[model samples]
Target chain A: MSDPLLKVDNLHVEFKTGSIITRAVNGVTFELNEQENIGIVGESGSGKSVTATSILQLIPSPPAKVANGAIYFKGKNLLKLSSKEMRKIRGNEISMIFQDPSTSLNPVFTVGNQLIETIRAHKKVSKKQAKQKAISLLDLVGIPAPDKRIDMYPHEFSGGMRQRVMIAIALACDPEVLIADEPTTALDVTVQAQILNLMKELQERLGMSIIMITHDLGVVWETCDKLLVMYAGRVVESASVKDLYQQPLHPYTWGLLDSQISEGQNSAEPLASIPGSPPDLSYEIKGCPFVERCPYAQDICYQETPQLNETIQGHAVACHFQTSEHQLERKEREYSDGDAT
Target chain B: MMETLLEVNGLKKHFPVSNPIPFKKSTQSVKAVDGVNFDVYQGETLGIVGESGCGKSTMARLVNQLIKPTDGSVIFKKQNLIDMPAEKLRQMRQKIQMVFQDPYASLDPRLKVGELIAEPLVIHQIGDRTSQKQRVEELLEIVGLNKRYADRYPHEFSGGQRQRINIARALTLNPELVICDEPVSALDVSVQAQVINLLNKLQQDFKLTYIFISHDLNVVRYMCDRIAVMYLGRIVEIGTFEEIYANPQHPYTKALFSAIPKESPFEEKERIILKGTVPSPLNPPSGCHFHERCPVAIDICKTKEPKMITKEKIHQTSCHLAD
Candidate 1:
């Protein structure tokens, strides 16, 4: 196979406040292929957003810093690039859409103005030509009556409409990679479906790879090809969506899957939830980050940290007892029990 | 047959908009909760599922009398709460409690966890200071929190733990009916599960009824016995969870259910994507509020309003073309 489009190798990010330092993204490594969609799933403060922001070198400095790692896109390490060189590639090669569209958009500017500005920033085009392309981009995102709607401010559009505007702006420069961080989270379910469908359709038409960061498994199930389950600061599991859902390896993945209130769940039974919250990122840890929450954590879990290993083809897991028969027996018992106290 | 704990009859809440012109009275009003009706059976959960601005929260507020309704009556335990005196209503509030969304915003920053939970007991004069403190400690243990942590502030706890404290505060009054408005939407899946399981267990131990409001269909399906699907400040469908899931009569309900992403990626769902956004409540569509976005809307749906039609023993829907 040809080389991957984007390679993120052993990335570590941290934030410092005074003398205390908080490790946000610790040794997260993954690759994105051409036209492939990847979903990074995790709870709040699990470092998924930090990983995505670090790709564009967007983490605010002074407090936020990239301690180590390399982000290679098209045989270029983004971290080593100068501010001038990076600015050219930031939005031209890789663009991002944030969770809340209402805030991401400039309240004072018209939708057309923002889209045209993004287009003009990356490409040498006349104002008239940029306006024409902006109108077409708005139309491509399924905004009704793009000619008239283009003149309206951000507050005039609905939540879903504003999200479409955000996507249009992100795609204005025709970036090869689009990073969407919870793009559909703020909208209604029906609206979320519309946005997801729009995103899928756009990916097919534009042939661009996407990095989708969200906490919803259902969203990933419908949209993503590969999945990365993050806990605390590290990736606990990574595999194709189908394989990971069918035969998950890590205990964190199992807990996440079981915690969901599925359609087939009995109302009388209690949901199996992870018992404890995520660990504090400011303190140094000697072992697994999820040791406190994992029901099957043993002495080794507290003493040593496990590395992400590909036990099967294209499926990686980070757990000390991932491939043991004893773990299999315990997993079976846990599944049979169904309820966690 | 289970007894009805609360009956809402033709409830309506409208906020009149001020006239843009000077010295002019405005005729326009936002009908936030227009003509909603439902019953909460004793020891049962009734879910209200709808999109934002669909009046789910407004209806919850109207039921608990946090906001007064423009019309209709709320009958709780054979007494009309709408017509009750303020003093009588204050006493009546002991039987009904509410847990709001946004755990961080719902709690006061200055108060300790124990004081926050015991505030209801202190207001109602239910127990002495010693007994209230003991009750707070007991509630902390019941909600699976360490008793010593009650002396700490709300900022010290995580989102799930703060939610547990909120649940404990709501239960302090021993309210027969608890109104949870989008309780788990803000939480992660793992923490959401913890809160949901806690609510379920508390209901069983206290023999409580719940009015669960949320936009998530899966959570609503798992938590509620019967559900009412709201649209544009009105209920489009109401039925048992099984009946609604198996055979949804309203086009809006069908579209809403189909819009939910499938549980597994391998399962393909025939999505019924609705055309436009929900209409503004200031002036809902002349007839059916959902006709503008309904896929199977007919001529009658635009000009003539549809009434609730009973399809099965308890399943009911309002749609011109349901038959």
Candidate 2:
């Protein structure tokens, strides 16, 4: 489909400290289309953030390195790009917002100053012109009375407002791709709703593609079109939001959906949480990383690591036993049958 | 009839957050837990669900006597704990304990896991060194920890394992009422399930009463028998989990429930998005704390405070729209 807007193929990122090495992002691959939103879902240390950071060359090289794979954007592989070329593309083509807005924005600097500097860095605009653009960007993100709020320091704004400021800064360059890493995680649900709605509005107005990284299924369900579920370090499943939720094939995805404590999910038995803790990233995996936690794990699952296989035309799952017989309603499956123990 | 374990009536805690500048004589108070009321029934779990700064943590602290209330009283076992003698309060603390969020921060890194778990028993002088060590080992096993690992430090364990250690420590005193403040929020969904199942089993075995505080409605719904929805330092609604989730009367409660991203992307339901942020508790809307952000707020809501009203049996709400 017109060489998808951004293609991340077989990407691998690793972190080494002393004698130890961690496979942070293990051969993750995906594509992002123009105006499309992709959600990457995983718990802490699942390598979701590592994959995002590797795309921008943001991971520090001493300890962090991309061992294998390529990230192609606009027909050029990001891994092959010079630091200068990557810098130009970072804000002008791709921008990011982190989880904590309070730290993302410098507390000592005025919010307006940060936004103005970001605009000038990516565009050939003067101080006066960039300042004007900064005010409008703030206005665009729905910050009330942008004229007055523009001059306020980062500490002056509340958590939600600081997040809005972060968004305004990210949109300053009008990047074609916006990568938000847990943007609304720090805010409360009501405020998180506000930020999510603001993002939807901004995406429509800017027509920018977004890669949303989050653990909340509901946030992904509401914002993203395609969803990727990550475990230990690799993607276990990828599909359209509807397909992923409706007919999830991976045992890990199945357990994750049932693990959620959602409204109207009132079953008598304990939550169908995947048993066992997350797999360690430092250790090299001989078989499936999730074999320790998978309820349906069998001899095949423990013997070999499954490759990402397309079970349906648009849906892909990485599981040895993602057959029709194994696809039972999450509620009906006895995930708590103690196989994981 | 259910027996009441803890009764809180008109509990208030105001922190004077005045501008810290010379020549400014402002003494404004942040009503962190203002005029809150609830009853935790015997052997039942009561969930307190609210966003940050909504006083969920403050209310938990108040019940545990970590902070004294500015007004009203906390009656546990029909004894007002407000000004209980230090010796008496220390004794009462054995019947009530707390498990905090962020296991990494809650646990002391310097101490061995066994020493950390046995600290409570040691302080209360419940058992001598030998018995305390044995009890610590037993508690570790009950929470699904390897007994040998107790000799290791806190940093050696995973987040889920540390949390289990926290539970082991909290239960050392055999507290009848446990306040689990966001106990599972920091853990992964898989680990969260392990902890949830552990807590459920522990409650049944110990016959413990729980005051579960969390921001996740789904977790609260699953854990609590009755739920209290808080906003701007006040409970806007309280009811059975079924009553609250299925049919919420309060506008704030309704909007809060709708705001959750649906379980499935295909599940279509009209989402009710609330306007504006929660008003500061320092000057809480002058009347209904939620009126500023309430979807169906009336003119009277701007000036007249709404009292907690029982719309259905055992279901209480504080909204003008409830009538």
Candidate 3:
């Protein structure tokens, strides 16, 4: 196939607190096809957000250090780009929408000002033109009364409105890639659906690749074409959305799927939560990061880190078992039988 | 069937919004909770699901008497909680507690973990100092925290650990009913499961009733025995989990269920996307609050308010079409 729109190879991110260094992203690698939407799903501190930020070179300095990694965007290595080049790429070629709009947005600036500034930063346009573009962007995001809302400050808008404003700003430059980090985690269910659908529609219209970082598998299934499961700063599983849900290879993926199952089905059976807390990143480990929490962990899993292995078509799982085909067939049989009953 | 632990009738909380301009009409009341009615049965979880600004949190606070209702009666075991004296209210508080959303802010930073848990027991004068200490330790153990960490301050604990401590403090009084307002929304997905499991175990062990309020339908579906869907200061649907999920009658209910992300690898279900944002509680729609955005809205839905009509046994919904 042609070169992916973005390619991440052997990426590692470390944070220094006092004298100790914590590896937040370790040897992570993934490829995003042009105009494809991929979701990186994991709980907080799982390095999902960090991985996205690393691609854009948004990691804060002093404490945060990208020790090793190669991030290629449209055949250009993002890591090797100078500060000036990176600035041009950010919000011009790539943009990100953070989790909480209440805090992510500047309180003092009007929504229009933020949108205009983002546009002017990338394009040499007149102030009036920028303002017009701002209004159109707001209108595109489905914000009603865009002309009136343009002058309203962030605090004036409600939580959901503020999120829409953030989206408008993110799309100001019509970037080729959009990194949405937990975009709807703070919104209610109905509002969440609205935002997700809006993103999907915008992706189709703009034909831009999107990296959706969220812990919710439900969100991933709804919007994402591919799924990457992260754990303790590592990509434990990566596969097509259909394959991951149909025949999950990693135990962590199984656990996540099981947890969500009890939500959809009103079963009296207790939810199957992962056994232990996520491993501490401050200390280095010899084996798999999820070994402590995995129910199917073996001595080999604890003794040596497993490489990402292709166990089924378009499915890669970093686990020793490699029984995805067997499990997939079994589940299909059970599902058909259950439906027949 | 479990006994009813708490019953709320016509509960309302109206906050007066003052005009910014001086000498202007001073205050206009916002009906945050407008005549909401529900019950908490012993050992059962009642989930209150709503959008933001739908007054779910306000209802939770009113049930705990954190904020007194403007008009209504809260009958806890047949005693009118609204009419109860302050001392009597204080006494009643021992049997009812609350767990707030933000673990970081809800906890006292200066106080040790042990003192945080002990404060409730001390306030109610449940036992002697030594026994209270022992109880605090026991509570920690029950919530899956090591008793040895009780001396540590709130800042030292992880988000999940702090929430576990919050749950422990809420359970210190052995309350019959606990109101959890978005308790797990702030935690990670994996940690959310851990805290939810702890809550389920505690409910079973102590026969505690829970008024679980959340905007997340997934979490509510897993936790609640019965679910209530709320819109601008009103409950649009209330029924058993099975009844609502399997056979949702209200248009809003169907829209909500469709909004939830499907887990299976099947084709996507056509979502009934609501038209507009939730109406302002300050000035909600005249008739049915959801009529402004309801896809199946009729003329009567905009002109005449619908009453809570019973469809199936114990299933109640406020929709003109349901009639």
Candidate 4:
């Protein structure tokens, strides 16, 4: 309702491999409001991580060029910022939690040292104060006996504990927005739930907006307030969590949901897998990005790119046939029936 | 009723932690897999679900005798795999194959896909060189990869395709039981479905038995006929898919099911939110391993271990409250 904390408009990212330029993020646009939890869901290589990395100017240059885009963070144009200014903003005002904590964390450094260094980099504080803050942050993220464990190296910690340490470092600066890329993918279900719940609690406590990038729709449903469905370097659907799940207008969204075998479902029933692999993003395309894999793709869908049309309350879907109320009704009927038992 | 393919009783694997303290001689052992027991029925997928460090992977490896069990017995086809000799174990390995989690890491980079698939057949002396090549092509086709792609190396294939190649290699020997440890966990959700479907197809076509080990409950719910929920290196609950999903007995099982993200547009359930990490395996709780984190823990749970009791027909759980 209020002005977005971060607004991305017409963002296009291209990766050049010799003669070929792959459009990784093509004309993508979205906004994250204050205290909002938004999920960017897509299969691997769909540019979901690339788009998130672009927000913080973390993308590698030469190979990856933000061909055209406007990234407005808190009314400031992040794309236009100088390297010095960007450095000040990165890890100070915005922090990220990467997928693999084992790799993200320096194996040589003690957890305490990393946390203290991270805190001291952004703020001018005494060593004692910074160490205290580090221990506190670790305690905040549910690490046990932060004081003793802080001195241990990353190898000493288990996978779940290492991820918690990553979270602690990410939240050390108390940033306005936290971008977590597949934060729980490497974790088990119990630990995944713990981390997700921890993130939710921290969000409430700090009142910081979150941009969670994951391919797991289950994570999105459990944690995110808004959902952004990506396909082939584009946003095919975006809506509030309730609106998106209750009545997913896009066929791609339908396929993603249907492919998920719910806990209560009959195990013997075959999962309705989407027919084909994700389209290759190497070449440019004119029509809908999802047309190749979309079961409901029509001739019109292949011929022209569809705009994000508001089909229902706060729900947007990029599909020509999304306008057909009859089809929508049928889909709604099927979704409810499938969900019901 | 189907015949039992593999029966594991009180399996244990303890890796001694070498503390770098002189004269202290601290023999802290990580109880990775401590007294896990289960039966894998013929032609059925027995899903082993657990959190990291809960010893699901170790169980899979122990069942295949990749690592000798520290204790207990693995009766594969009435043969004690734990005590089997090297020669006989090699023969047993042909009937029990393993598909690892990371396809890229599991596959040999230098070997061509065809050779990779044919290696298993050659080692087991299943067929001659010409026949092995033909069987490799057939295996490639079965796993949904084109026969032409067999000439390419592992690095050339995508993650999903590489996994398919791994599956094809696993099936080359026509092993009756396959230990697929987190096979699709490393893959994309969409690609995961593709791999899962291919696995299902292969199981049906060959009547293969699968020991599906993963941390994902949703995946286990989908692929397995029966599910075992493991915690602290022990099975807390075991039941048919229907019974477990419908009426999960153990508190741990209940929490696990509730943790799964539901797709329906309904109000979120109040997660059990267990407190504290899993206890240190070396110094696990005296009685119930889950007592420290169990919301419904009783006084007796702290003092005495609860043996797994049959709650219903073929449905079993190890909880003091259940008893």
Q: Can you give the TM-score per candidate against the true fold?
A: 0.98, 0.96, 0.94, 0.93
Q: Write the per-residue lDDT of candidate 1 for residues B171-289, one digit (tens) a residue.
A: 99889999999999899988898889889888999999999999999999899999999998899999899999999999899999999987988999999888878888998998899
- Point out where model 3 deviates above 4 Å: A323-341, B23-25
lDDT (10s digit) by residue, model 3, range B36-126: 9988787889999978888999998888788988999899988988878899999898899999999999999999999999998888777
How much is A87 displaced in model 3, in angstroms? 1.3
Docking quality level of the chain pair in candidate 4 = acceptable
Query: Model 1 misses residue B107 by how many Å?
Result: 0.2
**Model 1 residue pairs with clashes:** none
Q: On a 0 to 100 scale, what is the lDDT of residue A303 in model 3?
A: 93
Per-residue C-alpha lDDT of model 3 across residues A1-341, encoded as one tens digit per residue:
99998999999999999989999999899999989999999978989988998888888986899999899998999999899999999999899999998999999889899999999999999999999999999999999999999999998887888899999999999999999999998887888889989999998998999999998888888898999999989999999998888777777887777656444554255655665578789999779888876666679888999888777777888876675544421121101000000
Lowest summed-lDDT stretch of 10 residues in model 2 chain B?
Answer: B269-278
- lDDT by residue (tens digit), candidate 2, A7-86: 99999888999999998989999999999999999989999999998888889997998899999998899899899999
TM-score of 4: 0.93
Separate DockQ for every predicted complex = 0.62, 0.59, 0.44, 0.45
- Which stretch of 10 consecutive residues in model 3 chain A shows the poorest summed lDDT? A332-341
TM-score (C-alpha, index-matched) for candidate 3 = 0.94
Q: Write the per-residue lDDT of candidate 4 for residues B95-154, one digit (tens) a residue.
A: 899899998799889999999999987787887888998998888778877888878899
Which of 2 and 4 is ahead in DockQ?
Answer: 2
Better of 2 and 4 by TM-score: 2
Native contact share for candidate 2: 0.64
